[model samples]
Target chain A: MSGTRGERFHVGTRKGIFTVAKVGGAWQVVEAGHVGDNVPIVMHDPRDDTLYAALDHGHFGGKLHRRPAGGGDWEEIGVPTYPDLPEGVEEDTDASGRVIPWTLKLVWSLVPGLDDQPGRLWCGTLPGGLFRSDDRGDTWELVRGLWDHPDRKEWMGGGADWPGVHSIAVHPTDGDRLTVGVSCGGIWVTEDGGASWACRADGMRAEFMPPDRAGDPRIQDPHCLVQCVGAPDRFWVQHHNAIYRSVDDCASWQEVEGEPTHFGFAVSVHPEDPETAWFVPAIKDEHRVPQDAHLVVSRTRDGGETFDVLRNGLPQEHAYDLVLRHAMDLHGDGRCLAFGSTTGNVFVSEDQGDSWTCVSTHLPPVYCVRWEGRASAG
Target chain B: MPRVAFTPNLQRHVACPPRDVEGATVREALDAVFAGNPKARGYVLEDDGALRKHMNVFVDGRPVRDRVTLGDAVSPGGEIYVMQALSGG
Candidate 1:
């Protein structure tokens, strides 16, 4: 699969979800939907080739839709919903004393379950709620273990208005094992299929937290968490302020420094190479533009020991593209990669991070990109 | 029975034409309207059954006072308008 070609993909932008395909050696947006709406997340289920798009209509609220495997009309599906705030619980507050309303703010992460669990789907949402759907998003129920954890109450938002679980990684072999990355809530792992959870973020530091609480795993934000499919024990995270790599199934982490900058949002691991991964670094904080007004993707071929800033086909002059956490994705072949930026530019690389091709320059602000994988589009 | 009609803007996402239903309050009227049009329910109200902050409901040209419970009284022959606030965008 590593030698395969880049074919079709989807980019979820601030305005719509576009279906981009490589037809006759050229990339084009073959189809587009929700043309003037906010689509924050999209998922291409390789198991069934099903495409799910989460459209957050600012006024009408968050909505989810999907096209079945063989590709059909877009059908509206149920969004992850939170149960009613229990009666008499008017003051549902987090540790920071902020009222965390029981509402569906936005769909941050939508992932399909392991191969064995075909009908199962996992969803993460803002205000920090993890949900499970057994019917391909037709219905959903909130998972209580992670939401009810005592430490979750202490989880506060980092760069967002509310704490959210944005990244969810399901174990390739163990369907019961799952890991989730919260914006400011650290990393939580569950081996009992969401029945219970444990915080495994030990060495990740948070410069934004107080000196005494800087190492608190419950509040140390890991912006994105990705596990190496080839080496399941290896994991990498683009933390809020630093980059860390874990080689023990997230049991511990070691800080890895970036060259131009150490802060960024997106990270992608090679399909079968634990020593290879890519990241998009930014200036961090108040100014989120690319470092030195140059957009580049950094690649680590030796498991974080060293990195090469690849910018052959990327913009290097006065470019302000911030690749979001969910905006970058790699095809199963690893050589075929793509990532979109907050500026609405979509770039693809057929030869890994060696070079890139700009697919679109004027779409909505890209929120997520899902590359077509090994599975057939059917 | 009161008549419930969604703002025209909603038709683009979900079709919710005017419907006549028996109800004494805004919540009941909406509940009756959503009974047959389940797809439009999430577009109008939140999961907890509260009216969306950006969506306003009016009964006979008056905005409902109780947004949470939608308990504002609705006259038997009153006309209900579910309008998306202009500022909501």
Candidate 2:
């Protein structure tokens, strides 16, 4: 942290959100808020230096909190609530035939609005609902097009009892265009700012389902999706069964050829380089721990043409931790990449995934990690 | 008035100090408490206004029969308890 001018890393864990900033030459916990609440995601709005934390209360429900940039007490912002079910539409049913009601179980992902829309924000929630907020986190409206899509009936759950929109990517150049990744429903794209949505899982595969339905778009599962900011057309998806790269803005996807293991929960892409990406590969869906109990990060500098395992500082054996879908992140020009594990370990690689250093080992099971950097004013 | 109390576990995420609220039914008693802290209402009840699956309500050491509408009548000086169900990994 010697050259840290304004670098902050927030780790969202099962117990709370931990704020660590570079003090002197090492990362130190400047503040640890939400002491006993489960923080699924902590996002920093770079436009205004505001931080939003999605707190998941097991007994209760999900709650959203925000704080200013420099750090202070968090103010509770109300969580998103779904509107009444459309007339004549029945409640969703699970595999067991139990009717599932619309509830905000968790705020899985939060993305800042386009550059031109100052106060706009987007949120993805469990139970497969996407919401938009025009006034920051104050008031939210559900994206009804996706909610009422015909494919929703076929959508199933991968990790939860119902499908959830866990990844949302707003195009850097086209504010109206965006993509959303669903756990069991696959990839969806809306070019008209959520007025309409279409499934983009044509080439993605879902091997976990029955053979007849494995290739269906609604049954595809994308664990994580990342878009290269420098090349908005290029995107990478860590699918439930394979790794896919799409060059046509998710119109069609092709499996990345050189992955050691085809399964992982997290994917990180270089901020400025569409060709460079990172993935923490684990065992198959049945066993999610690191492959062979060895924790290694696979880096592909040539856009998935080939991959090199980076494990200079990571555990080589008996490491049973798995990184959640949002537990890994890349910041700035991709000079820094950080990831956290369910075993309560956090690691950072400042040199673009060539090596790593342990940031913390005693945190509660980490759910997500994010990086915020402030440039030095000359 | 009924003596309404929230378990210590629920207090971790919300501030719910045991207090007396005037109401004839369980829903009325909870509504009186929610009037003071609107945020806590979302945590305890779903958007459809039903008790969350992980939450349980007890009246005088017995579980309430009407969980959906919370229409169970409260006896005079009855004690109500709100606690989280034991679940999850």
User: Which runs in model 2 stand beyond 4 Å of their true positions?
Assistant: A1-6, A88-90, A94-98, A374-378, B1-89
Model 2: per-residue Cα lDDT at residue A179:
92
How does candidate 1 fare on TM-score?
0.79
Model 2 chain A worst lDDT run, 10 consecutive residues: A369-378
Q: How do the candidates score on chain B by TM-score?
A: 0.96, 0.94
Instruction: Give residue A330's error in model 2 in angstroms.
Output: 0.3
Error of 1 at A124 (Å): 0.4
Cα lDDT tens digits for candidate 1, A1-378: 112555778999988888888888888888888898899899987777788989888788888999987678889998888998778888677653447888988888998997789779999998899999988999999999998888888676655667888889888889889999997789999999999999999998866543445588987778888988878889999997788999999999999988678888899998788889899999865467899999999999998889999999999999999988999988887787899998989999989889888989998899999876642111
Global lDDT of model 2: 0.81
True interface contacts reproduced, per candidate: 0.00, 0.00
Specify the CAPRI tier of model 2: incorrect
Clashing pairs in 2: none
